[model samples]
Target: MKIAIIGTRGIPNHYGGFEQITEQLATGLVERGHSVTVYNSHNHPNVAKSWKGVSIQHCYDPEHMLGTAGQFVYDLNCIRHARKNNFDVWLFMGYTSSSVWHSFFPKNSIIVSNMDGMEWKRTKYAKTVQRFLKYAEKLAVKHSHFHIADSPAIKDYLDKKYSVNAKFIPYGAVLPAASEEETLRQYNLAKDDYFLLIARMEPENNVEMILDGFSASNCKKNFLVIGKTENKFGKRLVGKYGSDNRIKFLGAIFDQETVHALRANAQLYFHGHSVGGTNPSLLEAMASGSLIAAHDNIFNKAVLGNDAFYFDCAACVKALLEKTVCTETKKTFTRNNTEKIRQQYSWDKIIDAYENYFFECCQSAKNESYVSSKRWACK
Candidate 1:
């Protein structure tokens, strides 16, 4: 099937969850003898002309004020391309941007939209943007032939808020590259020596809270946070926390091997995302066999299982620190849970799920298009 994937920064996946999923899924589909084209942002310098047997269509847009509007501009360009491509299916990865394209595409086109978290609820957007997002989200849900929710929490949110039925498919992760010894040596630390936090340093991710909590912790272990220096929030975080050598802030790590090594060998993985569905980083850490200490959200709990430790604030940190080695039963449970994640959340399982969804949407589209054409001919 000819598939067009829309709504992301672009193909090489230097950035976020959607891009990573797009890269892996596109490659996997290509290997399975499906023709896939990923719409990429020309603004991203590292994006190649082509990638992994998939065509990368570069969509150009001016950098206006830099944020949601910029995204909309890029997405509009992608939609223009999507309308021209005549793809068997258009798989939209984001909520706010792709829904607007529904009016442009064939109504019978296999439109599958991923209801990626509640974008309106995110703290980053302004009141006007939030209002627009709420509308776009509604249209995306209302128009799509199929909807994908990355976690049960997201699926439930859509069901409750939008009264829309969405299929739940969790994100997958690859294992880390760094060996236990090498991982420890690279960081110049023993196992469990540092509290590691991996996330985009955005307000929604609770970056400040993570830093403050670690600083407030009387625990012996140092804190190591990894993320991209994206905006003012990141700058402020660096200014506040980066000065402390103990609070090592590694910014924007692109090398997967290095990231995996750090994640896999960390004494503990600190997941600070207060919002969003099944985080790819947290899942990757689990796949890497890191002892998980995540924010106690439903999404995190659902992913980590009851075996993992959860904390909301400084007091929670004190409890987590005190219970570290004493919770051998918890460790054992988490280890077993890791094995489960490795099996269930593997790339193979995820790719297969995507393939099935694609084909199903494509076939449905074909049937509906045929019926529409027949009616037009009769008229």
Candidate 2:
């Protein structure tokens, strides 16, 4: 099958969940002997021309600063590419891009969109942006041949609000091997001496809350939070908590090896996502075999199972700190969760589900085409 995947920054995994998902699925499809081409935004630096087995098709996005307009620019360009190359199917992620492409693209094209979460509910967006996002979400559901929710939590949202039944396909996780000792030395973090939190410093991520909780704790364990510092919210977070030597803020960690080592060697993994479906950070933490201290959400519980620890407030965090004997039990729980993730959330398994979904969407399109042809013949 010739597949065209769009709505991602690029390959390699330097970006967020969507980029990682795109890279993994495209590559996995290629490995299965399917022809897959990814339309990546040329705004970001090139990580690779080919990742795993997937081919990259870099495209221009000039209206980047215009936010939603920039997305439209990219989507239309990708649609043009799809039509020009005669791609068999079009798969995309993100609600805004999906909404735009589905509304404008050829009706016969097999379109499968993965709308991961109620992104409009995120606090970062102002009133106007949220209103637009809500409408865009509806457009995405109404127009796509099929929609994918990264978690049951997100699926429920779509079902309730849009009356749309989407296939629930969770995100995948890759178990990164331990990095060399030199990698740890480079970050000045000794193995097992510190805990790690790897996520965007967005309001929904609850970075401030996590910092307050960790700060209130009496545990001597150090903290290393790694993510981009481009946003104003991120800068304010840095300004507030960065002075404390115990809490180190390394801005924009692009190196995969360094990130893996940080997670793999940490005493614990802190996940502060107050919103969204199964987070990639949480999945990556499980893959790295780190004991999780996550926000109290059904999504987190579902992903990590009951054995993983949860906290709703700083009091709970302090309580966990008072008893720092989490080493043995936490590791055991982490290993158990790791085994579960290996069985359920591997890239091979998730991508195969996506592949099957695309094939099904194509079948649906063919059936519709056949019916239309039959009606025309009768006419």
Candidate 3:
């Protein structure tokens, strides 16, 4: 099948979750004998025409200059280019910027969209922007021929809200071979000596709340925050906690090996994302065998189940920080999480699921086309 993947910065994964997943999925599909093309922002670091057997299509992206509005232009560029390709399947990774141009999608292609998290619920956006996102979500559902939900909770919501059977296909992670202790030396950290939190520093991510809880706690261990701090919320967090010698704000670190090492060695990993589906970071932490303390919400609970600790408020985070758990219990939790990744969220399994689903969608499209032609003949 000829597949075109849109709605991400690009393949070699210089950015975040969607790009990483797209890189993996596109390469995987190509390896399985399908022709796959991934749309990349012209500003993306990787300028190559192909990477690991997957084709790359670069489009103009002006987000650096025009800010968020530039994303619409980039999507339009990608969609316009895609219309001429005659792809069998067009997989849209998200609906936020591209759904508004649904009318321009190729008439003959099967449209399959991976509806990302509930964007309207995010506190980062203004009320008007949230309303626009809600409208965009509805438009995506109304126009797409098929849908995918990364979390079961999201699938349930889409099914109830739009009366569509959205497929549940969560993100996948690669299990680390072993902990790279050397990676920790650069940060001046030793094994299990620090508590780690890695997030976008957004309000909904609860970075401030976690830091507040950590600061209020009596634990003597250092707290490491990993993410870009140039944003308004991040600057506020730095100002509020920068004076604390124990609280270190390490800017965004994209090296997967270093990140995995940090997660594997941390005394505890805090996941505060309350707005998204199966988060890539959470899965990586699990795959790295990190003992997690996720925000108490359906999305996190659906992934962690009974394996990790949960926190709702600052007080809950404080209590968890101060509480002592036996080594046996910690081992049990980390073991369960790692096993979950190995069994359920491995990259190979996710790739197979997507491959099979694409085949199914293509077959259904063919059947519908045949039936329509037969009815026309009868007429």
Top-scoring candidate (lDDT): 3
> Taking the tens digit of each residue's C-alpha lDDT, what string does model 3 give over 323-344?
8878999999999999999999
**Cα error, candidate 3, residue 323 (Å):** 1.3
Candidate 1 lDDT at 48 equals 73
Give the range where candidate 2 is weakest over 10 consecutive residues by summed lDDT. Answer: 370-379
Q: RMSD per prediction, one decimal?
A: 3.4, 3.5, 3.0
Kindly provide the TM-score of model 2 when superposed on the true structure, using C-alpha atoms.
0.91
Question: Which ranges of candidate 2 are over 4 A from the true structure?
Answer: 47-53, 63-68, 326-328, 368-379
Q: Distance (Å) between predicted and true CA of 90, model 1?
A: 0.2
Task: Tell me which residue pairs clash in candidate 3.
Answer: none
lDDT of 2 at 137: 86
Candidate 3 local lDDT, residue 132: 100
Q: What is the C-alpha lDDT of each candidate?
A: 0.77, 0.77, 0.91
Q: How well does each candidate superpose onto the true structure, as a TM-score?
A: 0.90, 0.91, 0.97
Model 1 worst lDDT window (10 residues): 370-379
Give the top-scoring candidate (TM-score): 3
